[model samples]
Target: MTTTSPLRSEDRGNASVTRLSPFQPLTDEQQRLVDSIVRFCERHSHDGHAALVMEGDAGTGKSLVLNTAFQRIQSEARDRDSTRSLHGMRNILLVNHPEMIKLYRNIAATIPTLRKKDYERPTSFINAMHKSEQRVDIVFIDEAHLLLTRTDPYNHFRQSNQLEEILKLARIVVLVFDPRQTLKFKGYWDDAHLRTLLAGIPTETISLTEQFRVEANPDVMTWIRALCDGHLLPLPAKQHFDFRIYDDAARMYDDICQRNDACGQSRILATYDFPYTLNGEDHFVQTGSFHLRWDRNQPTHPLPWAERPESIDEVGSVYTVQGFDLNYAGVILGPSMSYDKVTDRVVFHPDRYEDRAAFSGGGRITDTPRAQCQVMANALFVILTRARQGLYIKAVDPALNERLMLLWKERG
Candidate 1:
């Protein structure tokens, strides 16, 4: 199951520090933000404090930042309460934001002590917390981007929502999120909703804007930032990227793979839409770009594979790789990001693009006009930055991939 995911040892009990170095030391702004966040946690480590938001661009080191800060927070919390059901808040469960309350429910279901249908909505959530007495010092949301807004049809229950329930239960809550990586309004994302959830507390929020992923100068990085920021007009309002286009994905991949064998590890990618569309055949994952594959298609599998599997490790969606990282990542922009010049606009098959979306129009935007650009930017952010030194992009559409070709051509 090593598919698109990073190597996960069966017992992930052993913490793995990021081997990658910082692109640049945290900017004064980032340091100030981290200082404030760290101090807030220090004060609240004993338990009970206002909520905090860890805001940043995707792959800007927010995870690393939060993780490092959390270690200190846990250490401080333990100093205060030795018997708090956690050696260092071991009772605390860091859940993804989108599936916030639902995640709590799912974990509760597994425990025999907790009742599955005990209650619904926030009431259910609070009741469960009360039953478990998860009165720890803090509650953390790891992938806060998944946290949805109220407009989502999939999420009907308000009180049971992740944000709402966390407010109700935890003495202190720390949520790390990048609106850039946010999915959709499964919940509500309006200012009104934000105020209601985080309204009162003086939010010690900061945006991590520096990119440690792509090794580029300010000029080139600016273009990448513009694309992701949705400042690039007519591009679905997302942080776009600069890349090298390839008419032949397979040939380019073969060359990269060969080069990788010569130097070090390298990867090949393709969208589910044309999984193996590289040489012109559906040889990769049966699923296209949208469908995330963790370890092949098999659900139950080993964690850190003794030996890397065959094609399973070769192709996967961006989602599967989220959390996990690698030495080098190569991306093939499938037909998904293809903009038909004839149509004069990009056309994305809803089923292909990644689910994450940036906030743009005042309403819910599907995977077509808005979803593709934002998700692709995020994917690019992750893929490019994962490699310590290099990033390779092979976009199929001659038109779309050409934007990337400029970087290479200019280099020459």
Candidate 2:
């Protein structure tokens, strides 16, 4: 069933280069929280202050809040009188993903006050902290859960942890974090660990309950969360949100392509069940009759999978799809996941899991099988919530597929 590779080098340059539109209007809850955060920044513009942590799950407007707050703070700094004490304060947005940096930089280029350099990676921000004589006034970190610990190879300067170094870099630190989004073994930050790090400092923590993604349906989010936690099965329901179970992989892929053609943003995602090699060879994901290559390694571009047209034929993994959103997401449950008819629940097969690095190196971090399975579950949950409008799912296990079909019948 292997076919010719659909991704070509020529298709890379044909990607659309339209400027990012203005951010969606903030909800009333988001606006209220933003106002409070801005007030805190204004009061502690000069002094070294405690960090403010914003916690939320997938689809919550954490990115929206951080982006809006960064722009508002920059405007306030520019408009302040030169004689005022808070004038000329420097602020920067810190993130770990290179694609996210490029994405935000491209968006910032459209605004007059914002600069591309304002968005940076963790290592770059830490290096800048050592050179600059003046402390950064405000630092906003998106995806704070991805912060590396001392075990990370990127910690060349031997910093204790990312949180410690970031606190030293800025007086007013703002972190947007979700513990469930941590995909790698090196990502060590959590609620307990963060609280321990900020023991001596005064901190304010806020929780976001509203979900802006997945068609803004709370029921869908609840079901996804329950499924990830192994509290419920993958049952179908006739809810307001769009969710479907497909018996054929090819049909699911075809539907994803059609959605992309009509909506301009859609892709197929799969679990890391196939061996991933770094040698740049094409490895196809073959399930039953459906066969397609995994996403290619594009060295030059920021986010080739989402930006390029040919990427529509490639299947994206968690590493490529994380920290990004899509109009529709078609998820393929590979060999790693299965349904236990005896227990009547979903189970993860660790031996079949391909991302060995995520399980290795951290001897005590994820020792038990259940712990490793939880990480895999987290990866699945992240993929499921990437879609803003709809979700199409296909399971490879026969028992799982049959159960899904039965659930759909029950929904009627």
Candidate 2: tens digits of C-alpha lDDT, residues 1-412: 2333354332223122232222557789888878877877776665667688999878777877888878877766677555554468888989887666767787788777788888888877887788775578889999898787655654554565787888877888989988898776666445788888888877888877787766745667777787777555445456655688888888888777777777766888899898788687988887877888898877567554666667788888887777777878899988888888888787788899999877754555645576678778889998988888888888887887788777767766
lDDT of each: 0.48, 0.76
Per residue, candidate 1 scores C-alpha lDDT tens digits across 260-284 of 4444444455443443322333344
Model 1 CA RMSD to the hidden true structure, in angstroms: 8.9
Clashing pairs in 2: none
Q: Which ten residues in a row have the lowest lDDT in candidate 2?
A: 12-21
After superposing candidate 1, which stretches have Cα over 4 Å from the reference?
1-16, 19-35, 44-49, 80-93, 97-134, 148-160, 184-196, 226-244, 258-265, 271-312, 340-385, 401-411
Global lDDT of model 2: 0.76
> Which 10 consecutive positions of candidate 1 have the poorest summed lDDT?
14-23
